[model samples]
Target: MSFIAIDRVSIQPNRRPLNDQKVAELMQSIKANGLLNPITLDQNFNLVAGLHRLTACKLLGLEQIEYRIIAYQDVDHARLAEIDENLIRNELEALERAELWLERDQILERIGLRAQSGENQYTKKGGESISPPPKTTVQLAQEAGYNKRTYQLGKQIAKNIDPEVKEVIKKTPIAKSHSTLLKIARAGSKEREQAEQAEQKAQEAKHQQKQEEMETQAKLAAEARTKLKEKQLIALQSSTAQKQAKQSIRSARTQVEKKINTTPILPGAELGDEWILGRHLIYCGDTAEDKFIGLLPSNAALAIATLSFEWNHDYLIDEAHIVAVLAREGHIQDFCARHRMPFRFEWVLGELYVGIYSQDPILKPEKPVGIEGVEGIVAYLISLYTKHDNFILTPSLGHAEVLIACERMGRICFAGDKATENVDRAIARWQKWTGQEAKKEKHCYT
Candidate 1:
């Protein structure tokens, strides 16, 4: 190699490190050793190699240094020689290598040397006077091992990025992943619209899931409430049945006691001497003096009592006897007065007395004169017995007896006089009084 004067050469301003400390050290070494290796240059005296050493000599203010001026016709071979030299030294940073590779491509293009296939150069063939430079900045970057995809994406990033953000990117080197992500962030309205659509779809899916969960929970709660209500109804029905059975047992016991206490008036006779005429008779003692009469029905008796009345062989005598008995009972007389009945013995013991004055006057008695339908009339009267204070009707008896009594009374007064209307009105009033229509219909009728 022949050495020439450094002042005769011009270094190409490319691929130089800007590190202050590294430049300072190289300047100190050049000042001491005086550039042991010469820089390489083209026939026009333009630098083709030794860029770092030339920079160090200039920084050190050296008056003279060594270099070699080669011809432009040999520049391609010279560039390849420079590249091989740098590779052996491993002296370039990634950015520096990128810049050097880019410069080599430009030189190849200027000389009309197209890179062979897979050679990564740009050039034009013969007969071309002048043409626009081949290889854009993006294509040059790709050949330098800068990712082509990234370079293509970077163009988009450069296009859409805010001026302020572009300034920041130019000043600061960001990691590749972050750079790509930022490019996406900087994309236009179309990209943003796509992102918004994705977000909305996700939100709708979440809302539908929540709504379905709520509906499922509501259905489960409703089912649980229905099961609880059914359990309560069953318990109530069981309690009612138990009460009815107890009342039945009590009524049977009362009837048995009455049968045992009754004394026969004739030999081998079943009829008693002092028989009380009423719906139910309960005997209180085992002896004559100890015996006290219980008039009217007990709750237990009323629950199961059926109405029945008959005229005996001594019907007139029985009528007379019951009349005498009512007269002797001061409370019975008072009951008649309270209910607004005339107190004369004729009025008490006449046709009216005979009418309701059999052995069991209030039972299924025969029709009296002027009472055309005696069964219906007596059914009406016995129904009134259930309404009286001393009746002692149980819950079941009260329910059935009151409903029947109301129906009978309403039928009698309003027969053929708007029967349906009267019945509906009476039923409505009765339901209001008892509060049992709905439950009764559901349980007993349905």
Candidate 2:
């Protein structure tokens, strides 16, 4: 066809596939070889075809390109012609062919145009009755000389995905496999849910693994602490054992040293109760030296008495023995009082038989009497003569001389010689020798 200037035509807004890189390539080709053919347009000056070529020429900054103007009535026929020409000679890219086929089908549907019928689906009645063939997606791709697989996928995506998603797919540079998978995911709710569950499970497993690792670390730390404590305890026990052994050795050494250094004294012959002299002999002397001599007479008398009794009696009277007997008798009254026994002349004799011993010596006082008599003698003797004082006499000596004599001789005779003639006679001789009566005057006898 003859060519015309591009200024007389307008580009149609129908979708075109001119990307920046494609436009740049086309511009390079145009700069090298120039436009091989012009674009076509309708009377309204809308480009009915050759959109990509116009875009390529514009991007190359060309002031003009060749084109042909046709009336609106001829545009439809021109579009068919243009599609046929590209299918035969141009060999469009798979995606471009798919887009062209889809657009042609939509335009023909809108214009009430039918695809060419198949060979014998219906016979003509009365010269002309034609039925259009049902065009499948595969048949359309085959006619367009496009990949059946690519065309099928594109048709499925166009039908299934929302217009918004399709727009995104068209604009975005996503991989073909990923886009296919996304389309499948959009088509099936089960697939989408399953993918979400797999992602959730992966996260859960990671969290559980982290927790298990933390627990293992904690267990190891606790085990380490226990081992350390046991070691410390063992060390402490060893130290304690060492210290105890040292103390035991020291104690044993001390005891052995003490036993080696110690010495004991031998016992004396006079162990217990060995006495020196009697109270009567002691009273006969005025001093310690005089008392040693005065004891000689009593010792001689005891010796003589001992010799006399030895032939007939089992008991013996030795000087040391007589001294002990006298010392024992000296504590008789106090011994009787301490033992809670009645303190009488007979009690004094009983105390003499069993040795004079007491836990305590401070005896309780006697009951009060109308006129103190026998008890007065005891009081006066205890007050005037005790072991602490120089005048010390046995209970037997005092009781035998006073109370025994009074009991035996009768109270009146013991008081005065006038009560008995015999006593009086002895008294007269005693008085003549002393030149005084041996009677106590104004005696407070009870």
Judged by TM-score, which candidate is best?
A: 2
Deviation of model 1 at 220, angstroms: 66
- Tell me the tens digit of each residue's lDDT in model 2 across 1-446: 55555566665454445567766777788888987767777666677667667888876667677777666566566666556555565535433444556666666655445344452323323225443544555566777666677666655544433343334445333213333323332443333344345455545655778766555555554454444333333322223233333343344335422121223221111211112111121111111132322323222211111010112211212221211122143454443343332222221222222222122232211211121233232332222112122222221222222222222222211111111332333333333322332322221221
Alpha-carbon shift of residue 174 in model 1 (angstroms) = 3.3
State candidate 2's TM-score: 0.33
Model 1, 1-446: lDDT tens per residue? Answer: 56555677765443344556666787887767766778877777777777777768776777656777666557566665566567556565433343355456556666654344444434434464654444555555555455765544444443333334333333223312334323323434343344345455545655777666555555554454444333333222223223333343344335422222333222111211121112222221111121111222213112211111111112122212221111222344443333222122221322222222323322221122232122222233333233333232111111233233333233211010112332344333333433333111111101
- C-alpha RMSD for every candidate: 43.4, 58.5
lDDT score, candidate 2, position 282: 11
Clashes of 1: 2
Backbone clashes for every candidate come to 2, 0
